[model samples]
Target chain A: MDRLLNIDRRIIFIFVLLGVAIPLLIDIHLPIKPTPTVRAVYDEIERVSIEDPDRPVLVSFSYGASTMPEMEPMTRSILHHLFSRGRKVVGICLWPEAVGLAQPIMDELAAEFGMKYGTDYAFLGYKPGAQAVVLNLGQSMAGTFPFDTAGTPVGDLPILAKVQNLKDFSFVFDFAAGDSMEFWWIPYGQEKHRFPFAGGCTAVMAPDLYPFLQSRQLVGLLGGLAGAAEYEALIGVSGSATSGMEPQSVTHVIIILFILLGNTVYFTTRRRGGKA
Target chain B: MTRDSYVFVGFLALFALVNTILVANGALSLDWDGLGVIVAAGCTLALYSFLYKDNPLFKFAEHVYVGVAAAYVFGITWYNSLYGEIIVSYFDIGEKGANGGGHNPWVLLFPTLLGLLMLTRFSRKFSWLSRISFAFVVGVGAGLTIPRYLSSFLLGQLEPSLAPLTLSWAGLNLFLVLVGVITVLIYFFFSVEHTGVVGHASRLGIWFLMVSFGASFGYTIMARLSLLIGRISFLMDDWLHLM
Candidate 1:
């Protein structure tokens, strides 16, 4: 009972490592239920695909390489879904590290769909001031990101020819690891530009965003890899998140069981009138 | 040289030699970016080594990551933002403009001056000039934030919280949300005495807050575990070809 009180953290780490690694080595597919929150994101994109396929979907890559594990799958899957559906994509990164991680993904996915770079998809690249860029975007895209990641001027790119501001686009999806959504996009971009806003954040940030979701300010939320997995399901494409879901589910169940066992052991020892 | 230092240098030399040989042989397969796989595997293993204890390898990997990030950012700032946006646009060297007409060099002069003023912070005497630029930033930020904050956080949230609660399941959920909001607000209200029902509500508020905290903690665990899983997958799939 006392050992359960303060088990060595390394032991837990080893367990977690095995918990994650075993599922990767062996193939396992887990059932997933796409909640209404994830459905909203899919439905919004589907709506655009049906109504106006050429409308450039604005994707703010607000995450960095450090969060690539959670964010990369979401980024790749969403791009796959959008490009496969014949929706034009425009991307920007607030986090500088996102450049190295996201650009290659956009390239691979676009190539898979036989999408042209300057015409079908564009990477606006990294910007310095986040909120300032968001505010400036509400006014003008060319003014905010004058040059795409390739250093070709916006005027030279055909994808951004009709994209002058936020309103010209169809949907807003912010793949964020930080407060880019709360402080910048939610306040300035969505409020002023009036685009349907959706977000994919690290799981930790998801619980804090309930207020925004409840207020209907955010049309949908992708909470984490779980969210990414759900999005993959909605698109009917099994990507990295889907492959990784079983391990994640197993790891979570292990942690929950540990908690319950620990609690139970402590109480049972106390009931026996012994030190725990 | 010390024996330990000799061992360390020999280890590194051997590792580099093997990596190059493997890459040359295309053992990792050129399609996987063989050189990249070796380097990534080395860095990933080096980083994971710190879980056992701090070592020179982990420090080397950490520094390499930071250096690469810094160099990447500097290149982007020069090419994408500053040079492409400013120098080319101001001098009519680049084609992008908000309205398609070329930008006036005169229009950029004041902004260019203010930007230069911000650089004066490094000098002893001229640092006072940087205050003006800082003040301008702070003043504009304050002005813009007031209305946005009022409209988004205050008015927007308040309106939704005040929605009428009915008897349906949806309504019951809304009712629970409203009660949680009110009780939480009451818990923070220090103006009134909290001896009886107010204390009870405050305790309930604490329970609700605890539940929220617990949910956040659970999510945090999931987030961290996912990062671990991601790295392991990279190692197994991309580097070692174990998957």
Candidate 2:
């Protein structure tokens, strides 16, 4: 019993690695149904595009590379939707690491849509303070982002020419891990900026944001890999999230089996002792 | 004072001084409107005060942050409501009213009342009065979330678990989902005694939970590592062109 209780953590680590890696290698693209949360995010993006194709949508890449696996699919799908509808986009990174991470994705997607970088979209790069940046955006975007990510003056960009504040954007989608939620939602979403908001957050952090979602502070939420898969399904793109579902499914099953086996061993040993 | 405390304070002072100088010299520029580098430097120093000890400096900075946040929020609310809702929606500014209304000024009453009710939290005698506001907020929140949660969490989770049992690879997925659900459930079966069949199941569930937790932890590590890798990549590829 003690042996079972104190099994080497390395053994468990190996089991997990195989469990996640094997399914990933298999590349199983499981069909996913869009949950209401995922659908809500999709519907919001669609609505914004349909309602005002000319107005730019602000997307805050508030997560760093660490949360990319969970957040990237939603970000890609949302951007795909926005660009498909011919809406301009302004991407900002609150996390220092996010500016670099966002550049490739934006460039790739913009290329797909044949969209000009400055005219159709722009990356505002990273800012130091989160809440302050959000508040400044609400007040004056030009003042907050004087230049684009590449250091081009904001005035030179046609897409940002008329965008004076948060009100200029049709809606805001915050693809974040957790740091900027209180900053973006409480101060900006709930208080200053009345723009409809949606969020993409890691699963661990999803439940905490439910209150904000419930209060209508957020229009939709994409929670973790499951949410990401659903978003991919909605966009008709089988991306990393869709592929990841197989591993997620396998690992979840493996954990359950181990639990059952451990319990079985415990009961059988106890029963033998009773018979003795 | 401890030697470590003094060292920390000295380092923080140096950092603050450098930050202030950089901002003043336009080395670190921002896109927004504010007291420029002075406020940034002060806030940075204030936040860093925690490293030395939880003292008056940290408290002052924390309070200032709250105050500035509140002020910014007030400015935004003024702009949104006064401009977006009032001018655009009620007064039909720029012919952009969604509902085409110029005289439905009564719509502002609900928000006004709710805002007023929230202020009651400041008073002891009428603290209970805040429940009215709370009730309204909670009621609406519940109405919005319950239905969405049902579809998003319950139905969405169950749908994937209902896959058909087969002998092929697809069957493996179904098997995994079934076992995962059952075992994960057992892990959470805390109220029941760990005896007989229940004990067996519970033991299995614990392993499942541990492994799942381990996998999650591993992935979290990967994510963090990715952040580090990304920063390095930037420093190389974008900054110095070494990559």
- DockQ per candidate, 2 decimals: 0.58, 0.03
lDDT of 1: 0.85
- Cα lDDT computed for each candidate against the true fold: 0.85, 0.68
State the lDDT of candidate 2 residue by residue for B1-243, as single tens digits: 887668667866876676566556665554443244345545555664564457666798899888976675455344433443445445545433424322255765676577688889999998888899889877866674555445544554566577678999979967875776787687687887778887787777778678767766655543442332333333333322332
Clashes (backbone N, CA, C under 3 Å), per candidate, total: 0, 12
**TM-score per model over all chains:** 0.91, 0.54
Candidate 1 residues lying further than 4 Å off, grouped into runs, are A1-7, A268-276, B1-27, B30-32, B94-103
lDDT of 1 by residue, A1-276 (tens): 778787887887788888999999988777989988888888888888898777799999988777889999999878999999988899998988888788999999999999999999999898788888899899978778877876677777888888889998989899999988888998888877778889899998999888988888899899999999999898888888888898898899889988898889999989999798
Which of the CAPRI classes, incorrect, acceptable, medium or high, describes model 2? incorrect
**Compared to the true structure, candidate 1 yields what TM-score?**
0.91
* Residue-level lDDT for A150 in candidate 1: 65
Clashing pairs in 1: none
